[model samples]
Target chain A: MSNWRQMMPTTEAYLLDKVLYELHHKPDDLAAYNEDKAAYLARFRLTPELAEKISSNDVAGLYEAGVNPYLLRAHCIGMRIPEDVSLAALRSLMKEGDDKWLN
Target chain B: MAELTGIYTASHTPVMLNFPDRIPTELRTEIFGAYEAMGRDFEAGRPDALVVLSNDHLHNFFLDNFPALCIGVGESYESPIEHWLKAKRRVFTGDQAFGAYLLQEALKADFDPAFSMEMVLDHGSLTPLELAGLDPDLPIVPILFNCVQPPMPTMRRCYQFGKFLGEAIRRYDGAERVAILATGGISHDIATPRMGMVNREFDERLLQLMEAGDSEAVVAYATNQVHTAGNGAEEIRMWMAAMGAAAGLPFKRAYYRAVSDWYTGIGIGHFGENSLATVGSIDG
Candidate 1:
């Protein structure tokens, strides 16, 4: 059981995926979110902590919290974060042995 | 009586369609050629309907409620829901009767798969179909498994379901010629640190096992070493299902390339008598 392998998604992670899923599918919701981030996130009832993480583009933190990397990437895209920026954030969090899948 | 026309598996990466220029022109041509070849063979199957085994990419289902296995019984499905995918948006004709039959059979077989009358397919289903240039009019019975989220159906479970699916297809009195298209993976991580890394070693081994008709080894190897391959490799569960449906039939590889830029190890192949055989010719 590798540390990085997908585990059961936590409630916060699930909620994050929900928010991202909607934004990915619904352009209007995304536009609204981009316009008023707090008001948009408020509808989901996301905690201030989780909201802060997302608002700050905390890819590594979200990934560590078990947010599905796929959805997390989509979230970054929804946030208009560049692929390189998100990848760098994720890579910075990588541990020494996390590269086993790369072998 | 309805009979299995052909059994096939393919990698359904959106990049091949969305970012074909990411890879060199020669590789793109080769990959496209492979898909076209498979399409030609698949068309020759003359299947009245196709059973597509793929996973929803968080497009149709969300974490709030995700089913381990879901069958679409809709009269039709609109695909490439991303809207940004390079493929055109089109309505995929659905074989509702066949899908309903499969759902009933699945329930009777002790597999409680969820049923949907309204389902939209993401890249997982559309990419391969479009790349192959298959007829748009060809109706389909799409079976979506939870390959995206964890706690997904195990490789063995997928294979068993596939076997049951094969039995159900044989018992079908509705359509005479049916085909199965399982689209998913051979190794490459997605949205992770090793995102673009391709695990050719893992891909080749699995493909070889499938070609040799060693379902036991395939299931065992995939079950154990899938973590080493990549998270996206979980999509191999679909391939296991295809192997299950074509149990005892050896597979033939149509194409394989470890295109890192494509962000996945792409592989295509089919099982049974004639890898390229048309309808009524394949061993049911």
Candidate 2:
């Protein structure tokens, strides 16, 4: 909650990091992301369930699997996802835990 | 001895550039106009180097390891990352000698900080340069604080850091006319549900203190209290740091606006001795 902790070791943790990094520095290729998705994802040793989550681009599901939402959102910022989409997706699963502390 | 010629704080959120039309023209003029004013007057000071205080948006650092504070000590730097900003890649001269001098002096002052010779200038630093039409060739010393990732340096700690930084600059025997530019936050968040929310009241409350040179009061806000405004609003650590470096001198308002389009309250202010121009006036 203070500084980010180690990303939990899970398929989503391993695969989502790649998803976000690719989306961040090379977002133009998401369309191509699917064509070779298996080949790219194969390297992660992910189970079929986690591969599905990564390939589906389920941010909420990934978060449930311990992928940090903040890091996930960096992908949103880089990919230029619409604000409403990101808000609806993220809010469905997270409360922004620290909001009540506001003065 | 090196002299701090100017001190400034500005919003570096990139949405303002990407969606300028999202904001009403009147607000745009008011906010950017203030940036224009600051740019003109800041350049008038002809600072040999501008040290920009900002935070990385996970652009260069990650969860594996993040320094609470970092300074670029390279001979030159480039803002090459293209995903968040549309700026063309261009080389910028870095005042490494001065950066190293400040680093040594800061350590001597008891503030432990990390130093880097390689890094990219993200929107947190570059957007202000673009907004103000600042000269890229104007040698820069980029200083970054871990304002985004939380568990960051306390607001008071950041101010103290700047205070010590100012002392270091003054202690250096170099001849550079230095300026300090702190970027980001006047109450706005991004990538969170609160994205697009601007706490005008919160921004103004802090601005009032800044204008009055109340560094202690500014730092009194608990970190969570500041986050109440917005997540990215945490970048106010930059403003607090600038206030400290300014040595408690009152700053003149450059501009203040609650531009929801950028989802940032977007405030600008400047501090200078004798050269404190009137609000909204571009001192020639």
Candidate 3:
């Protein structure tokens, strides 16, 4: 169970991005999305490097470290990044947009 | 003839205590006195119910598409989670009849307002209730707007809604003297780098405009000058609506204080054509 949960999206950025993506495209399947996201995070183990990057406040680096930029931005700003920022930041930094997350 | 009774507008002072040094003794007395007077009126006949307009601060709604205007028609309401506010009481009842009437009137006027039966009152509502000395039992119709968050309503829309609200209250068949209260915003920022900024000059000017019953100017200023005043200045729209409801009536500036520490310009004033002198002192 611990290993499976570790593989899931544990970071706040990943959770937020998952929530946003689910809200926009597959809104009807939010329960499934949340459950799946939680499970995925539980399975995806947090690497020490990623943990250190977040703790060190390397916002951009943490995004590059396989942490969802959308989620990282939310954690950094202390609020959900506005939809515009979420879309733009994902595109410019991660080469990922709303569609990428939904898929 | 319908009796146009007391009209109250309050700024939600975030501070825990009524600091004497920050709020001058004279001003506190005057403001408290006005509230006492209003409280007395409520006890005497009380309006059929109070029509209150306040802003919601991310408690009921988030960044995802909050309505510009929403009303509570619930029979009972609770205060939101604010351990700091230290509200002395919990649970307030809503006047269903008045709420329904106001909703119908607002809709007739082309204002599409959302309704909630189970809603929580934030500091925006709690602070005004505290300052006004209102009994917890006072039946109220709560109207919440997205003032704190972005994608806010236009000043013109708020003013127009206030006008419609006044008409709605008058149209109600109930004989109870109706009082309208608008709470929140006298210049303070809660979000972003400029948090804790309070604009005394802007607040004073706003009070002056409200006293004059200059809705047009108030709306225009809200559109153009609110950002300069403070991000929280949008809460002033609630006051504009209350003023609209009491148009053509004499409004008294009962109390005014710019508490720099609290980052708020707190003021309590009343509107009623037949109310006493423009200024009076309350000794407590």
Candidate 4:
């Protein structure tokens, strides 16, 4: 009910949320984590391009593809992107005033 | 039975970590002095358990399973946040006994609050406590609210939740004295393009209502109305919870400063004793 736009429920958004949450909180077993990640991604209609963008910590790309900066910033951090590096990308994304800005 | 000894609200942000850079030295000294003053008061009250009401920074949960309100029942909590500030980090001890009782009572009251045995403490729960010099060994129950992202609960609902929580604390059979600490924003925009902006007018008005003990006026704040100030202003949900827990109690504004450089209002206050508020003093 606030001025902020509602969260996106797309596969990309779901994938990003899980990816961030898992990166910060992963299973102790490596094989189990890989298997779990596969099963989780399988549930979504994720394209290879979207997956690639996330893997690369491409925050600007994520933003352009409908991922809001709030979630994107978390993703960047979980992926271990340097603070200055990720924060710079986030700032650019917010200031872009591009069509991607849902607000 | 355990009794509510002190109820407090303070600001918690990265701004508090890098104080000299964010706030001027003159104001910073005074602001920290207030926290020390409040800390002295808290210790003198001899509280045993402190219930911290704060917001998570999307580090604990995400849009997939964002909890509106959550109670931590774990025996201990760690802060994985603050890598940026490198703020003094500590593993705060949790009060599972009191937390479990609070959870059960809230559920019985028809308020479904999520309970966690493993919850991470972020700056929201730690910043103010460390700055205020709260005894680290004191048992803590961290109650997190959804202040970021959309679909935040209304102040009315949060107040109701707080009322139930207060009742449960009062009903618990223990000799322990409990203190309620609500930590977050008065008015600051952390996410939006206006990231460093602080609304002094909104901060002042809210403080006035608290000093006059007008919780009804405080609860009347709808989500969208507060959005006009800033997204971070949403964290005032914590303050509303404090008011609800201390409803009808007289209060005093401990300190207030609109630190634009820090992107925080730096508002702190306390609720104590019962006193009838003059009706329109709140609305005006």
Candidate 3 lDDT, B187-253, residue by residue in tens: 6644222333456667777777766776677677767777656556678888777777876676666
What does the lDDT read for residue B124 in candidate 2?
82
| lDDT digits (tens) for residues B134-179 of candidate 4 | 8889999999998876667888888888887777788788536999
Q: Which residue pairs overlap in candidate 4's backbone?
A: none
Clashing pairs in 1: none
Candidate with the greatest DockQ versus the true structure: 1
**Which candidate leads the pack in lDDT?**
1
Q: Write the per-residue lDDT of candidate 2 for residues B1-284, one digit (tens) a residue.
A: 77888899888777766667876787677777778778888888888888999888776776567899998898988885546556666777898988898888788888889999988777788878877888989888899998765457888889899888887877777656888899988777665545566677677778776666666777886354575687678788888788888896777777777766677777788877644454542211
Please estimate how well model 3 matches the true structure, expressed as its whole-model Cα lDDT. 0.61
lDDT of candidate 1 over A1-103, digit per residue (tens): 2424457887877888778788778869878887988988898978899888877778888887778876876677556677678777777866676676554
TM-score list, all predictions = 0.93, 0.85, 0.69, 0.80
lDDT of 1 at B175: 90
Candidate 1 Cα misplacement greater than 4 A, ranges: A1-6, A77-80, A101-103, B276-284
Worst 10 residues of 1 chain A by lDDT: A1-10
| Best first by lDDT, ranked | 1, 2, 4, 3
TM-score between candidate 1 and the true structure: 0.93
Question: Poorest 10 consecutive residues of model 1 chain B by lDDT?
Answer: B275-284
C-alpha lDDT of residue B9 in model 4 = 82
Q: Which CAPRI level is candidate 2?
A: acceptable
Ranking by DockQ: 1, 2, 4, 3
Better of 1 and 3 by lDDT: 1
